[model samples]
Target: MGKIASAHAYANNEVAYLAWDIDGKIEGCLGFEVVRIYLEPDGSVSLRDDGEEDRVPCAAWVGFKGQRNPHWLPQTTSIWPVQKLSWRDLTLRKRRNRAQLRPSEISVRYEIRPLGDWRPGLEPAPDPVPETVAVAKRGADGRPVLDADDRSVKIEAKAYDGKPRPLGYLGPAVATNAIRVTRWIGPFQSTFTNGVLAAQWLRNVIWEDGVKRPNELMGMISDPKNGIRKYLAGDVLPMLRELFEQAGSFLLALYELDDNELVDLLLANKNRIRLILANTGLVEGEWDVRNSHARQALIDANVDIQHRMFNNSTHIGHNKFVVHLDDDDAPVAVFTGSTNWTTTGLAGQTNNAIIIEDRNVAKAFADCWHRMLNDPLDLPTEFDDGMPDNQQGAPFRTSNETPARFTLDNGAKLEVWFSPNMPARRKSSAIPPDLREIYRLMRKAEQAILFLAFYPGQSGKDCIVGEAIEIGRTDQRLIVSGAVSSAQAMPNYVPGRKNDRNDPEDDEEAVSPHTFTEANVSIVRASRLDDRDLLSDFGGEELTAKGGIGAIIHDKVVVIDPLSDDCAVIFGSHNLGFKASYSNDENLVIVRGDKALAAAYAVHVLDVYDHYRFRAIEAELRRQGKKGWSGFLATEDTWLDPYADGAKGALMRYFARG
Candidate 1:
């Protein structure tokens, strides 16, 4: 329709990514208007007695340069269309006041209609189909049709706005694939929090409501029925609640047990929960006090608790996982990722959680929990005195034997490893086994190497970031992109000489000039530009910092060659560094040959990286006294030239071909 070639969509729990392809060159086409049609789970039209099957018009917050307004009133794409071929619909949510339509339970499709020349004050055409009729079975003559199959039945039509001929009349709409807006991927499900404080939606909400502090903001959007809580915790809390309802016992190992809601849930289900609670080290007193209070409650209720009260900072149990066992004591599923069980961990930082429904994976994690419960200190029988950190032995020791390898029911291959398994006295040049496996993948990455991390161990040659940097330097054809929570997490890149990946100097801000210059590597730090330094259109609204957690990017993930058949996703509590492998209690999994899972993770990595890359660059440009380049859109179409050549062109081609 309308020379449109293809339309496709991908969705997670919170957002839908819609893209389209045109048949030929856009000779003089202005833009496109996207309309979303929320459908039933069976892919049937949404029929309602009170209202029409909501044909929601996707829109942009800002208008043209001269047409912009101070109120930030959004203009529907039907009038002011999107200039790009693809858009992310962050506004998708469950229909309000409908308890039956849960998050990730409904499906949606899109229609991409090309827009022509337009003028001011143009309104969309009147509705053609009546509210009483659910389907467009009749033709323009308004006569009922006899033969109406799924392929022949009409569901939508082009929009009109009362202009001449092609002008103000939308082109024929091309239908896109229908997909359930969910986080499930076969036996694996994942969710990510919208916890970036400087995000556009959060900023708009804060500016409009004058809501300050995390609790206030949380209270404003905490209604589970409306699915707004997904903004703070994604599906983590819901998934946990559902797991609690299951007829199973929970094996939970936590570093921080302070979220009141979670504590309440645990107490309610205390009869089936066995917890291994750890200390938060010599840290904040508030966290300690709250944790102690929560722990005492669980203990008072007689919950089976194994307290790993190691007070040292360097060697503490840093695991957050829950393994579910059936009533017969057989493993069913496991929940493990970078997320902690604190409100700040769920609502303050960007984090991820994965639910692996494979029994073997759950069993592996269950084994780790059992080992920790049995031997909290992981002491060696010989009691060696020449430990690396002047300790009796490693705090976690699942690394002595080979990691568990499994073939999932869906043909996905997985290798799981637990930490604190390093030998008491190993060669100085030896690499940690987990880090070694990650390096092997990094060295052999063909298409792209992407990652997101928050201080994944000290930046050095032994870390995954350093390995990616070295590979990107040597192979200019590869696409290597990464984002860390801070600049200090990156290595000090050098031009010709070796990078100082393992510098012992205690410099928080490491200089890496060759990041986007001499090498193909591009490392962006999670940051925001000062409001005063931004364009005048942005005004002087300050960014919000909520909760106690300082880190904004807490996800620890890596996707290698996500578009290829050899895709691998490395994630979990593992920090992708030596410390996590050799000294801390962590779990890392490597999934090979699962392109779907890899692509999902790749989308998330690129999403977070792209969001922060512009902010980092904008801040850097303003600091260098570069004006006009840091803010505002170009007045004319000259901005399109960059997408036809150079770095932008290469990136566009990479994804288009992939």
Candidate 2:
């Protein structure tokens, strides 16, 4: 076996570094997450020891979001060069220059089973045992401890007779030590196809006045098909530079914009630009991974500016949008989505950018962009119409009459949403208007529901759609990846994803496959395109063909029955995760009464699901091993395409036969 790649597993969940040996080779496939990536003096990578300063390239301690992991144990590691995964998207991890290898914290999960329940006979059963568990203080010396350090899970164990105690001793409770479920990840590729790849000027020839009026320009570079040209982020720069020459003023909000070419372009016309970017996640001084130079260059230019834009601790200024104002100060157009203005964000990654020239829409986005520039900490004012249930700042009591939608002549209707709640001054968790639209679409589904989410946060949030699926009980499918969530837990029913369920905090309303099996929702956690998810005969092999372009389920898209009257699509960078709805500065477009668009998105969903479902199947086969799985596949290897019209029926038959 040859070594195709080596990676550094930063933590329990993330793979911070991946080095694909495109020309050369390495050996030994450990088949686990890579814990430490060391840089040698001569520019080679190592997992055993730390490397030199100048030679050491990109590195980060990307840890798990809500996992109980042992800090002392070796982080997960994996080796590649196998005949499986594709090596596309590896370029995105471009030696994050000038950044040091950061350290990460390990989380411990604590479980307090009653002396009677876990270790019965230790003491008589306490009266009215409500199963209340407490957190422990010490580490691995005596017993397991809970990872309560900034973790999302806050367990209120109702088994013992108490409340969720502070991160310490189990006050006057059972004499049982806690149970620790430490999670560690292995080396894997993260598809960051999060970039804006098209130019508005290039898409259309009919433009009234220099700007393309009523322009519905769309750009997504997930892999190019035969005869289709792949557009890169740099392609948009020349267009923007051209616009920069024309527009008198510009407003922008971005997560990161350190790409040298793009930075040079921005700096070239810095005088007229008003930029709002994210606050650095790293501290000041010493190898800065935040790319402070880009911000410094802008500061030096002295244009109207707002640095320290996002607060990852609270809400991210996760807006990759630009609002251009003409000489008269009238907002002309707006471009937005999940892309950062970085090099990897552009050419090396996957992304989408929609440029809408509707004057009202531009105004709304421009308003939000400027509002955040002034107050980066507090949530912006409710910028759009409210939900159907008479939310605090919504224009209507119900979604049916909300005033956020505007339509084009072609019968294509669009609605815009801004985050945090309204009245910018108060604390609000009011769901964004677009999310309510998602709920509406889920509820309206008479036949099917499909979703590709990057984050499906706590069970409560996922349950909003889950509840809809439960009610509809139709052909439901979900492809979740990148991060783990209790509401949408993976790991299979055999083991039951105990690690995900261990946290008591998600107890009240976490939704998962287990919660929705009664509704028959076919839930599958997505793997990188290179994994064994695709059927070899059914173009699973095409994964190698679509290398670098076969992206992760990064598209936060929802597709309802395309032919139905209420057929709808909700997409754009907005994550369905709880944090996305509650805090981050995100946007979602709700297209209602659009049959053609709905059908297109529906087909796209099928294409994505078919590509990954087999990975889930293969995972099962792997668990069963060579005999049973091999026997099943040997006889039934050739099946109809999962994307075929009668796929549901065929799937039912296959499962029934199996």
Candidate 3:
């Protein structure tokens, strides 16, 4: 007989996306129950040290807004089925003490079981199966073991505590393929920060005895602990420290270098580090004023350093990258991304960093570093113009040189490009090739185009935001969603891109800076419900919006057709704008045909988008003196009815199936 259901799991570092589908319709189907099994070192799905099966906990408690008898209670996935077709297990652990599992030390797989026979009023469904299953053989510690060898053993039969059974009833459990989830894929290690300091978790950390402790939060940023930093600065800092322990010389380029911890790191390893620091471009003052501490420290430590002021020029040195060379001075690996070497860049802003261990990628970056070292004042004008040995040129400036494509072991195509493609003295009217390629990808997107930007240039000819808007206006069926921290990144407020225009084909109609709910194109600004909004529904908890920390949506990422084979993700320190392309020293990498990586980025965009969409709407409602978020959950199951039709259902199905 055919299996009743099948499940799939995609994991990256700390989070796993779980999706399941039914083979056929079930009578009185309620939802699906999910259970995660932590395998032993030998791949045995054994009971945990606490004698409890490794079942994932529900992050949210499902309950009615006001009910005399509430069904919501703290429970595992085995007890309360997930109401959605897919769920994300953010807290993947192995033990009862709640210690996070290291990806290398553990292996995990999931089992999905369909739950049916729902009673009216959505009362808890009866126990679908036994609370715990009996193991045929077990050790004194309660973990399953082989009868002879005393080694941890695998259970072939499906049970609540052991391996899944092949045969079962109508709601048979379907197991997903196991995965050793890690942030490191092949020679690449990608890391992102929690960066949302305004989140409730931070509030919990800072609040003690009815007082908010900002100092405690600051301490956490400086010295991350308990995974609270969420690999933001934590992962990058450790990687740098690892390099210092190795026998390698380093090549460093940074825009801002004021973080105390990072400066200490550089100082400790100054003997082997060749540094190129830049001005923040905030003020035209003494070249070394902003980064004086780090620069002065490195200088005192006798490190080989060059400070690039980029003075008198409109462009600022905006690169934040590091390259490592072996003892023989051969390029080994390179770390490059949007993150700057500053406290705010690390712990405050939403940023990303990637460490690529490929020698070819490292060599390419190293060649650019050498070119910059040769000409600290002005970037070289040509790479192969037969210039004298003293006049080396920039490798990434010419179209023939850059948009360099590299193929990874997994068949993902990577294209790297550095900026300042145009001449230094002249302002070109033609669109830069780097940005035109991005616009082309957006226009040709078959399914969806999603992006998150700090400020991808104001709405104009060279603006990536404007290009996305124009594409949305032309093709109403294409899904365009994005989040931006700056208000200028979006257009003026309009009800709808298509409906507001007197003629549907009009090219000059103002696009909405706010959400375009009807046009299949939605853009939201980074905002939250502040003191002005009523929160009585949430136990009178206040959500205060603290400003000036840093950019909340600092990521410069664009995902085109994420679920398709032709998926492309354009991301890096490049602002994805004209100025970044024609002036600033920046890096951009385009990754294509890596569905897993594309989906990771797609989920990140959607996560940030959904978080702020409500806040953006609430802020607008507050502006209009209207009520927002009545602080109530749906009293009836009819709330799910909205997902049966319309754009909502379409979106739900699109992501669920993927």
Candidate 4:
């Protein structure tokens, strides 16, 4: 069957054309330059490139410069948005007495010449398969441990070909081309070669668990135009609802709830949605979770909340996320982070949230979410125990299995790590997949590492994940700064000199631990983060304030060597802590290959580091030669009343003490 194709999509939009040469990416003709086919007033069409008139091949495409198809695959370069053919309408407005391109442009009916007698639609330029290959190996949770260069280099059977030839577009994985792209990925190519296509984005949507308690839900709701409603309800909530309507099915994994408005919104779309909501009884106000208005609203919407309940009936279902599946019943989108669905959480507290649009990543999250529905009875605490028999909830999912690597738009990669933290329940059973991946990634750092965890009591140099980064630091490195807790357990602190692991005679390691405050890593307590005292090296940017959300950097982020080839960042509610590792249901999304992203976060890290490095100097003076993790302000009340604030801080400091 011959397919008649036309470059018609997105009714009433300008059209651009790309003519793919017979050369593959190996020969470096990978990027096809888009050209506009202009219709002269004489009814003669002329090509923008070299004036090719009647005979030209083109594919219809729509989207902004940096955007792409939802799947964003190689096939996406040829995805047809409108089946038959879409129209393009253009109207030029009055220019501000400036430069103009098309003189008072009007809509033009763009025409594309058919290639040969049959047009089999717009066929994407073929990709040449590689001679040798190494893709991500998956673990139980579908995440692979990327190598030091932020990718798992898999060397398969190598075959010698005469030279690079156009093997006729079979999905470019050919030898040297593979090596080149794999080594240093470029835009568009990464999204296709990697499994699921995702346009990588970092949206720092945060709620301040700051100094001033933001106005109540009612107060903010009253002024929908400019208050919390504008940012939270109007903005954030609608995106989720839109996702639900478009998705095939839904999974709700929340730690706490009570945001009546959000619940009501979900209820409004309940019939159109197929949802499985799992809560940890946090909304019941039993443990650390705040109260929410989920139950009644769910009941009103006839939403079934029974079967998937993960209340501490056994394990604390301390996970937070919502997974959406497309009509094909596969995962489409995922939402996760440190937020509990509550009026206060969205409108008041310092929190984080993320929305990822990737079938591969979404599928992984969906798999993890549905596995929780099985609700195993209990997890085996003993390292000696085989797989826990009950399989009650999302158990530790790991192995030396395979890792799934997803490349989104603009040469960016997203590697997801979710958990029951289940991995080796026998030998290295001590570290589950979630924590272990963190350990593996941190261990791969060659140059630098930056961290900013809202809560650090559960993490330290001695902790497994913490030790991975500390123990594996390159022979010489900067004085690490950020969370005060990670600063514990240092070898020795010589004010001006950096650590020298390669020097055979630098055995200052044998010095008495007492005099050296011993911590090579400088500690800066966010609780005491103050701009009045510290000057930022990045700019006079006021990151640290006397009081505000800035007072507490509540984001769990890890930026590894922002300027390196292996640049990457991992963050989410998945705090690199002991508690978050073994018990809490958390998430970590690692983004690689995007320099702009790494640099953006690099500024944040460097800013925090600069601010804290300055603060550490002041803190040491205040410490009066104290030799341990310094005490910091505690999160005593609001969300944690009756929970002795002193005990929590004291215990954390004690655990983190050198």
Best by TM-score: 1
Q: By TM-score, how accurate is candidate 3?
A: 0.76
Which ranking of candidates, highest TM-score first? 1, 3, 2, 4
What TM-score fits each model?
0.79, 0.49, 0.76, 0.47
Tell me how far the alpha carbon of residue 273 in candidate 1 is from the true structure, in angstroms, after superposition. 1.2
Once fitted onto the true fold, the runs of candidate 1 whose alpha carbons sit more than 4 angstroms away are: 1-7, 19-32, 39-54, 78-86, 94-102, 111-176, 209-230, 284-290, 378-401, 424-429, 458-461, 492-520, 539-549, 628-632, 649-652
Best by lDDT: 1
As for TM-score, the candidate ahead, 1 or 3, is: 1
TM-score of 2: 0.49
Which digits, one per residue and each the tens of the lDDT, describe model 4 over residues 246-290?
A: 746677776666667667666776764544444433323342233
Candidate 2 residues lying further than 4 Å off, grouped into runs, are: 1-248, 280-288, 308-312, 347-350, 374-403, 422-434, 459-468, 471-520, 529-551, 623-658
Q: lDDT (CA) for every model shown?
A: 0.66, 0.40, 0.63, 0.40
Error of 2 at 643 (Å): 11
Model 4 residue 266 CA deviation (Å) reads 1.6
- The predictions' CA RMSDs to the true structure, in order, are 11.0, 23.2, 11.7, 23.6
C-alpha RMSD between model 4 and the true structure = 23.6
